[model samples]
Target: MTLKESSGVDNELNKGDRLDVPFPSICFFDLYTLKVFHVLKLAEGQYITTFALNKDNTNLLVSTADKQLIIYTDPALSLKVVNHMLKLGWEGDGLSPLIN
Candidate 1:
């Protein structure tokens, strides 16, 4: 989406920034349902120049109009996978960690 409209040279993407000024946002959506799942929180007012998703779909790389490069990772994907017999949802059973 285009950035919030401003007047003059500061009107375009990533020209000038202010703490109180609100800018455009980028959102990630589920391909199957076309529903937004996550949003990429970029630097304020900077338009995305390019972006790439890793082959594993765990990492995202972004380039902005201001020449800023950023990478984002999903923590849930980074978390270790384990099978616990004493499990009762996400609550720690206190013994699971010791075994894992």
Candidate 2:
């Protein structure tokens, strides 16, 4: 669950931004605290293929092959975009065009 701790790892999360890493794993860090917050398990039987960041750098977009797209937004803000996506028929494929 935990990734190797190194300067490289820090580089991945330096700006509190989103990144699409191919590895089937994820690492969490606290921006304000600069601490290792979590080492989470990847979704069961689902390999993460790509990810993206909202323009404001407050939310994260994650994609998986299980026909799912997940959005992680700042808890303080309302999750309107995600709700809208759900409201519409926009499935996870909508994000494919934006991944590259």
Candidate 3:
């Protein structure tokens, strides 16, 4: 989808007091490949407060309103972290190994 369409879908998904709805995962689009290369779900019930990528694009920083900051050195590692969190039944407040 185009950026505009993606934004619209995101807004719709976030609308209302839908506490039961799990928050969408974070996804990174690869411009060169013209596709999504990574996705991770880090928090629930909190919007992302900050997202930053290092100058070399080798590191990523994501912060949520729940006072959690996750630093990802690479997409593969990030996917692994998110999957581990899910398997452990993370509820958005627990300490995570990925947190920095």
Model 2: per-residue lDDT, tens digit, 11-96?
55656665544356667879997676665456675667788888888878888878788777666565566656666756695542
Scored by TM-score, the top model is: 1
Identify the runs in model 3 with alpha carbons over 4 angstroms from their true place: 1-22, 32-34, 75-100
Tens digit of lDDT per residue, candidate 1, span 5-84? 44343555565443332254568668997666766566665788898988877778888888888888866656543333
Local distance difference test, candidate 3 = 0.70
Model 2 RMSD in Å is 14.1
Instruction: Write model 3 residue lDDT over 4-78, tens digit each, in one string.
Output: 587676656657634332355677668986466666766565578898998777677888788878787866866
Top model by lDDT, which number?
A: 3
Lowest summed-lDDT stretch of 10 residues in model 1? Answer: 80-89
Backbone N/Cα/C clashes per model: 0, 0, 0
Ranking by TM-score: 1, 3, 2
Model 3 poorest 10 in a row by lDDT: 16-25
Candidate 2 Cα deviation (angstroms), residue 95: 27
Structure candidate 2, residue pairs in collision: none
Task: State every prediction's TM-score relative to the real structure.
Answer: 0.49, 0.42, 0.44
Ranking according to lDDT, highest score first: 3, 2, 1
Model 2, TM vs. native:
0.42
lDDT of each: 0.64, 0.66, 0.70
- Taking all chains together, the TM-score of candidate 1 against the true structure is 0.49
Question: TM-score of the candidate numbered 3?
Answer: 0.44
Better of 1 and 3 by TM-score: 1
